[model samples]
Target: MSDHHIIDAKKMMITLEDVNKWYGQFHVLKNINLRVKPGERIVLCGPSGSGKSTTIRCINHLEEHQQGRIVVDGTELNDDLRNIERVRTEVGMVFQHFNLFPHLTVLQNCTLAPCWVRKMPKKEAEELAMHYLKRVRIAEHAHKFPGQLSGGQQQRVAIARSLCMKPKIMLFDEPTSALDPEMVKEVLDTMIGLAEEGMTMLCVTHEMGFARTVADRVILWIAGKSSKKRHRWSSSPHRNQQGPGSFYLR
Candidate 1:
């Protein structure tokens, strides 16, 4: 990486220009464009069909684009499966659903990816797994199965699992949306700790509090499009939403 990459460090690991997508005749994304930098923190929010999740999903090729370009960590996502795989290994994602394996112990969940994807030594992978589990404040529950843990604990495990991949960037799609009201804070706190440590994150969430604390900017997804243009909330944003809708990163 050159100084251009360094100075432009916030330049964009994921970039989309004039991107469009559709599901059958239903057009989902409309000329979507987004740019995420090396360690910048961004929050994406809006009404349900606003296409917040679709935007990030496009970065990893989870949702195929009908038109436009997506560049992840310098690699352009395309028809090549190999390219998509490379991008995924460099980018980690934590979803709304905890998505933990019910039959697997928490420790196993954390270790499986590093061992298989990174080809890390079993002992080393286990050590790294333990390290991240501790970071998520769940090392004590490592041997317990997902069914045995609370929703909050499972989300912690999910975070640990993603970190074990050692991704250069992290994507969070409404990570705390599925948690119980009280359990939301724990996971958000864990994310806060990571943000404080300078992890680049693109989060789709209604956690205005979390966004206010750490976001460099806020990106809104209109209908199904996430614009390349972004608005900087130099200071903290204020919340003014009434009950029916949710406010994020305020």
Candidate 2:
């Protein structure tokens, strides 16, 4: 875990090299270097405030990094508006909170982005929306507004909305963290299906069971940097040894 991993360069889909970020004078990410291969599922586990969310945000340029490089789907991340928009189209993100538009019905919420950002025709966008809604098993709720659905159902719609854009990579920022205990599985099940279909994903979550079962690698972040990464099949006796707030990436 202490040494750098050697991965085949040709297979890489995302690369973050010496990436750093800060909030005012507080350095948040410290020389982060990571490589994700196409179709690889990486689960980032960590305690709260350890920068897992910030790290993922940088990938999609939701939060600007102060230094280093982040390249997603071969596009280098930078301050250019056109490049940022292009990269975003290729990368889909699901937040911890279901950030669906309350005014829009499930179908409209899913269709809006593709129609606007992607310039897809409305009818075609709705068709794409329904396809993913069905994939997430929430097609029957398509006519309901966000507030009309349960937490789990709304989150599924949020996921379907992301999928409607046909992204090459999916980023989940604690997708199940805000759900009720009973509802977590429905969302996770949808994510598992995506993983099984070979979607390249970077998920920031503490769902260890999901990590153990679906992830190709589990990364642990501590004090704003990645400290350990292990293969799914590798045994680590010290996995749960850290303090509650100490943090982990996988």
Candidate number of the best lDDT? 2
| Candidate 1 per-residue lDDT over residues 55-74, each given as its tens digit | 78988788898898787877
Backbone clashes in model 1, listed as residue pairs = 208-248, 208-249
Error of 2 at 232 (Å): 7.5
User: Number of clashes in model 2?
Assistant: 11
* Candidate 1 TM-score, true structure as reference: 0.87
Candidate 2: what lDDT? 0.85
Per-model TM-score on C-alpha atoms? 0.87, 0.89
Give all candidates' CA lDDT scores: 0.82, 0.85
Please give the clash total of every predicted structure, in order: 2, 11
Q: Give residue 100's lDDT in candidate 1 (0 to 100).
A: 90
Writing each residue's lDDT as its tens digit, candidate 2 over 61-97 gives 9999999878777677887888899989999999999
